[model samples]
Structure formats: structure tokens, C-alpha cells
Target: MYDTILVATDGSDSANRAVEQALDLASMFDAELYGISVVDTRRYGDSMLSGSSGVIDDLSDRAEEVLAGLEAQADVGVTTTVRRGRPHEEIERYADTVDADLIVLGNRGLGASGEIGSTAERVVRYIDRPVLTA
Candidate 1:
């Protein structure tokens, strides 16, 4: 029932599980799989160390590494991306751009300290597509 499946990863354990689930679903439906990791630029406000300190670059690199790992593990071809912005917004925009049929996300990610990550919660609330939290 799914044509394009998108999974948001943060390199956290739960995110890894979500990736696995997305991979399986994509395989089952013979659908294309896309992975995205977003660097939350909001965290680094307008502080003196925001853009000039290489913090964003480091975060972007880490995000790329996460997507690379996801691509490596998938048996089916996977398209991966890294974005900079609010996690939920970036994820939603990317999903819409890809015309994804399903979105998979971890219940909690690296920055989450509760039962559900804020980004996942926001995406679930605002995005129109079906979302599965692993």
C-alpha cells in the first residue's frame, strides 16, 4: 500500500529500530525508501558559537553519517538526505517533496528525554500522511 517510505533517523537506538521497520515495510511493498537526518539549527540560537564555530558543520556531518549508515544497511536501494532546520518541519517538507506514502520515526531520539520525542510528536500532529513510531 506504500509507494515511497520515509524514515527519520537521529542515529539513536530507537531511530535504528525505526529504520529497520521502514526497510521492512519498503521491501514488503516493493517501494522506494528514503532516509533523512536533520540538524536542528534552532538549538544553536544566535550565540557567538552558532555558525562560525563549525558546530553546524559538525552536526551536518554527523547527520550525513547517520544517513549513510541507513543506506548501507538497506537491501533495497535507499535515497538518503541531510537537512538543516527544525526536525519536524524539515522532515515534513522532505516527505511532501518525495510524496511519501508513509513516514517512520522513533518514539524517542537523541534529544528526546520523554516517552516520545518532540520532533516525532510534532510531525505526527502536523503531517497529513500516515506515521509509524517505532
Candidate 2:
């Protein structure tokens, strides 16, 4: 049984799977789903950074939008969070803050498929909480 649940997402397909899985678990256990999306602001100054005025804000907004959609689809108790920073750091911090019984996240991110993302692996190593990957 679980109460509070947190999922780190990036609006990717795998993240969507995590949302669906989290939703199913929440419904089964009557748990509350807390969705989180972190915008890695560090990308702004990186060489790959594209020219943009509101890159950070845009990512935050997009993240919120994606989470909102998931919440709407779940149609149960759901909460959304958007932050700018390293994905693993923000997710770990959120897990601690929420004291989540379970932290559900996609093993793979928006990057390559069939392999777990580095951020997800980092979160698993750094955070002491439970993580269920979809």
C-alpha cells in the first residue's frame, strides 16, 4: 500500500508510461499522485543551447502543461510541480519534501530508447526512497 506518490517526467513517451502506471497504482490503492517535471536550466548556457528569450520559463510552462494533462487524464487526486534545475536533484528533493511512499519514474527519458536515462539512474543511487520505473 502507498499513499503519496511522485513521478519525474519530461513529457516524453516513457514518462507518459510512468504516468499511466502511477495512475493505475494510485487507483488501485486509493493513493494520491504527485507529478513533477524539472526543467534543466543548465542547458541554456550549454553549447547546444539554442537562442531563446524565455527558454527556462518555456520549459517550466511546458512541463506544467504536460503534468496537467496527465492529471486530467487520471481524474483522481493529483498534484503537479514544476521546477528548474538538475532533474535528479529536483526529483530527489521533491521525494524528500513529499515523503512519498513511492517514487515512480520512467527508466528511460527523452533521450535514447531501450536504456535507462542517466538521470533516472542517478536518482536511484542518490535517493533513499522507493522507485518504480515504467
Candidate 3:
């Protein structure tokens, strides 16, 4: 039973499976679907080196492109959000802020029994909301 479902995606194949599953659930319950893709802004290898680079725009643009694809596949009531921040924290905070009934995410090849996968694993450890991993 869910009203507002939040689907956290990383633009990955695994996350896409989660998206498809969430869409099916949303359709079944006639629930509103909310999709989000988070872009981690924290500097990485090159960023840490302070080398000549301008990848933030690249990342944001790429996210928007992916989000656009997601928006196209989402249900009629589904809305899309593109955020820039820590993946796990952003997903958890957004889910809480929206008062989401369910937080659905894909297991990034890291789930085994009680042990969760990468992104989902982190979100589970911090979020108080109910998480549905696919």
C-alpha cells in the first residue's frame, strides 16, 4: 500500500530496473510516482588534483539527459527531480521532505541477505523510512 512513491536512481542499469519495478507498483496502486537522479558534486580523482577541468556542467547536463529519458517512461502522474549532492543523503532527505510512502531503489550488485548494496546500503543505514530494494 503506497500513495506517493519515491524512486531513487543513479542512471545505472540496476537503477533502471528499480525504476521499471516502481512504475509497475505505482500503476498497481494508482500511486503518484516521483523520480530523482542525484549527481555527486564532490570532487573525485581529477578534482582533487585541482587540474584544469570543468566537469560540473558536463555532469549536470548528463543527468538532465538521463532524467529526461526517465520522465518519458514514467507514469502520467510521475514527476522527475534532478539533484546534486551525496546520493544516499539526498535520496533519504528528499524522501522525507516529500513524505513519501515508499522509497524504492535498485541493488547495485551489492545485496546479499542482510548486507545491502552500495547506494541502497548507505540509504538504509541512514533513512528511517521504509525502503524497497529491487
Candidate 4:
């Protein structure tokens, strides 16, 4: 009983699984699918010592590439977005903006400490919407 489904992806193997599941669900429910890939710009903060020169531009380019690939892979029509910011924040904001009925994402690996992956965990914590992590 979903009208709009938001799928957050990072182009990782785990994310690909999430994408597949999202697509299937969208098709089954006859819901409009919205896809997004967020480029985490925080990792490339403006620090000369970090040597992250041009990192933002590079990430933007990569986001475009990832979104394009996702669009191509989805059999159903997908509205896709590429954003730059904290991954979870961007995903949550987009979901709210679209009033998505469900948010789908992958259990992309964990941080060094072995907790749930930061992005997925943050999305689950901050967004008061249904989340399906594959």
C-alpha cells in the first residue's frame, strides 16, 4: 500500500541488494520509485592536511556515475537524485521532501567498532518512517 518508495544506495554490493529488493517491492506495490545516492562530503572536509583537494568535485562526479548506473539497472521507472552531504541526512531530507511511504537501504558494513553501519543506523534513528534494510 505504498505510493512512493525511496531507495538510498551507495553502489556497494550490499546497496545493490537493497536496490534489487526495492525494485521488486515497488513493482509489486505499483509504487513510484525514487532512488538517491549521497556523496558524503564530510569525509573530505576542507583540511589541507587531509589532502582531499578536489574531493568534492570528484565525489559529485562519482555520484552522477552511480545514479546513472542505478537508473539503468532499475526495470521500473525511477526518479533519481544525487546529493552531497552526510549520507543519512541527505537520505532523510529527500524522503521527507517526497513524503515517501517507505525508505529502503542496505546494511552496508559497519564502522571500525562493529556497530551497524553509520548511515543506515542514523537513518533509522532520525527518520520516523518505515525503513527496510537488505
Writing each residue's lDDT as its tens digit, candidate 1 over 39-101 gives: 888877867545485888888899999999998899999999999889999999999999999
Deviation from native of the Cα of residue 11 in model 3, angstroms: 1.6
Residue 8 error, candidate 2, Å: 1.5
Model 2 over residues 1-134: C-alpha lDDT tens digits? 89888977887888889888899889888988888999887755665455564766677789989988887888687888898778899998888888899998888888756888888899889889888987
Residue 18 accuracy (lDDT) in model 2: 89
Summarize candidate 4's per-residue lDDT along 1-134 as a digit string, tens digits: 99999998877777788889999999999999999988776765646426754776777787778778878887889998988878988998999999999999987732323456888888888899999988
State TM-scores per candidate. 0.95, 0.90, 0.83, 0.88
lDDT score, candidate 3, position 65: 81
Q: How well does candidate 2 match the true structure in TM-score terms?
A: 0.90
Which is better, 3 or 4, measured by lDDT? 4
In candidate 4, which residue ranges exceed 4 Å CA deviation?
A: 48-53, 109-115
Weakest 10 consecutive residues of candidate 3 by summed lDDT? 109-118
Name the lDDT of candidate 2: 0.84
Local distance difference test, per candidate?
A: 0.91, 0.84, 0.78, 0.84
Can you write out model 3's per-residue Cα lDDT over 1-134, one digit (the tens) per residue? 89999998767667788888888989999988888887776535545535633666677777788778777887557777888777888898888778899998887732334445667888777888888887
The 10-residue segment of model 4 with minimum total lDDT is 107-116
Ranking by lDDT: 1, 2, 4, 3
- After best superposition, candidate 1 residue 71: deviation in angstroms? 0.8
After the best TM-score superposition of candidate 4, give how far the Cα of residue 126 lies from its true spot, in angstroms: 1.3
Looking at model 3, the pairs that clash are none
State, as a TM-score between 0 and 1, how close model 4 is to the true structure.
0.88
Model 3 / residue 129 / CA error / Å: 1.0
